[model samples]
Target: MTPAARLSAAIEVLADLEVRRRPVNDALRDWGQTHRFAGSKDRAALASIVYDALRRRASSIFLLGADSPRAVVLGMLRLGRGLEADDIARLFSGERFAPDALTDDERARLEAPIPDMPAASAGDFPEWLTESLERTFGDDLIAEMQALADRAPVDIRANTLKTTREALVSALAHLSPEPTSHAEAGLRFHAGDDGRGPALQVEPEFIQGLYEIQDEGSQLAALLSLAAPGEQVVDLCAGAGGKTLALAAQMDNRGQIFATDIDARRLAAIHERLSRSGVRNVQVRVPRGRFDPVRNPQVADPLADIAGTVDLVLVDAPCTGVGTWRRNPDAKWRLRPGALVERLADQATVLDRAAALVKPGGRIAYVTCSLLPEENDDAVSGFLERHADFESVAPSNVVEAAGLPHLAEFATPGGGLLLSPRRTDTDGFYVAILRNRAA
Candidate 1:
């Protein structure tokens, strides 16, 4: 498809996304399925323009003075996409199927002055994210916002137990992006040839499960859990088992790890992943212990089975998912101030409950994809202060222990680790690793 057609497609997808509150991926998928004639390049270009628009929605509107998809496409071409004014005009020219004739007023706005915008505008984030963004960002708000504006890299964690980084690199060699090996067992790579995404999915490496598509930020959260071989670990809120798989890799497939969630279907999906990845240690507990192929008891509360008995428990809790703004920029518009408050309350409840399963000297690590301090630090503090047994520790210590830089730290009432994406290059994940006092 022509550039114009792709932009037009993005506009249609964005419109649907706004109305249904569906994610960009879903909208794009539905649209793509409907338009089978569209090739790989067309989809890639369309997704890029759409996400770029979403990333800078506030500023795009401010710059172009028009909020239509065409205006957004024009604004991105001028400002975010870095296209020159003439180029933008050309892209929207009548010769193309993209947009209708660009008016003089639209041209003027594209060339208008750009100055210091408000925090939301500068950060390219929602106004609702103002206070939380300030707290998490502190003085370097602009730099962080700029970082978020770019398309996200595709980072993968090598299943260190089965594969080495070098081996994984060789398997993914046809793909050009180099993978950077992190301190823990993470291999970070970006899709420079964005158009070649399909080749990666069909590769034997992905088929073999030698590497899994996880963000570097998420790998940090998994490492933050600090699971060891033969230690009983529970990923209490193992949504799709990203961290659960990470935890299993850490345990060296020697200990019992329970992959759990309120959703049965999600847990069910882990089996194929486990089988492909050659992981044998995890027992999936869906709907309160329904996996009979495993030894876990249906009568067991699961938490009670390990209450004060687990060497490690991880609560990669659900939140506003603010940190994942890069992948799902539309979420920013959907988020309301009230949702932040509700998320904090939810985090507190999950933290306290997850902590209960930690054995004396065992640790329960709390984590969120949110960049908000209310979700990151405040949740840890509220729980630590109320629970006399748990204490705080420096996050730098954990990162250093895991061979990472000391971006930030906090001591628990009793000791724990807190980390955010602004300090870490990964996702906007906040992790606190706390040890339960030994009896």
Candidate 2:
């Protein structure tokens, strides 16, 4: 398809998303089903346009003086794809299968120099988050949030249980894999101009479980748990067992990792992943009846046999996922105020659950892929206040012991670590380690 046609398709998909309030993938799928003539390249291009437009949605709307789908696409052409006015004019020339000719206002807005926008508008984040972003990032809020609006780098961690990072790097040398700045087992892949990364899943090494796709920040979160050989660790809310597998490798197959989640369907994939990665130390514990509210509540406790014996309990708690904007930009726009409140409640519940499983002198690594202070430091602080037996452990010590001392710069005053695209060149992640004192 011509670039103009792809832009039109993206506008359609964006409109569908706005009206239906459905996920980007669902909207794109519906578009593909209706437009059977669109080839793989055309679909890919359209999807890229839609995602890029969402990434700069706020700034695009501000610059174009309208919030219409066409305005976003037009503004994104200049702002995100770096196309000139002449280039955009060629596409929106009212030709067949192309968008309508630019109106006088659009043309004027296009030609006008970009005006200084509010920080939230410039960063493409919600206006409500301005204060929180300010509190979290201080003077670097714009820089940090703007970085999140860009594409995320593809990151993969070598499965130390199956193969070494050196060996995996040699096997995937064709992808120009570079060692991650901080994650010892992680390799980074920058996206191409087309906004697509290497398809490592099809590689023989990947199929053989030599590596798993994980963000550098996530890898560091698992490391902060400090799970070691012969220790008993419980990965509370271990969706798909990504970190559970990481903990297994860290323990050198000597410790026990009880990976449990409220929803068993999420654990279904972990069994295959564990088998693929040859991880023997992890036990995928599933609650009976899976995710049904009534059934889930009544299900037998999967970890009943191991409570209070855990050396470490890692609560990779769910949250608003603001840190993953680079990968799922549309989600940023879809997020509502109610969702943040809900996630805060879930984080507190998961942290409390982790506290119950940790033995005296054991630790809990509370983690979230959220940059919001309310979900990160505030959540940890509230939990500490509620449980007098648990006290904060300086995350700087964890970073230093993990041999990533440079990350100490992100240590919070309340004794947690915050990682962001600007600060750590990684997805937004917050990790706080808490130790349980003996009674």
- Candidate that scores best on TM-score: 2
What TM-score would every model get versus the actual structure? 0.90, 0.97
Highest lDDT scorer: 2
Least well predicted 10-residue stretch by lDDT in candidate 2:
289-298
Candidate 1: Cα lDDT at 227: 82
After superposing candidate 2 on the true structure, give the runs of residues whose Cα lies further than 4 Å from its correct spot.
290-297
lDDT of 2 at 355: 82
Error of 1 at 158 (Å): 1.4
Return the TM-score for candidate 2, rounded to 2 decimals: 0.97
lDDT of 1 by residue, 117-173 (tens): 787877788777777677666688767876666667677788886898788767666
Per-residue lDDT, model 1, residue 277, is: 85
Error of 2 at 125 (Å): 0.8
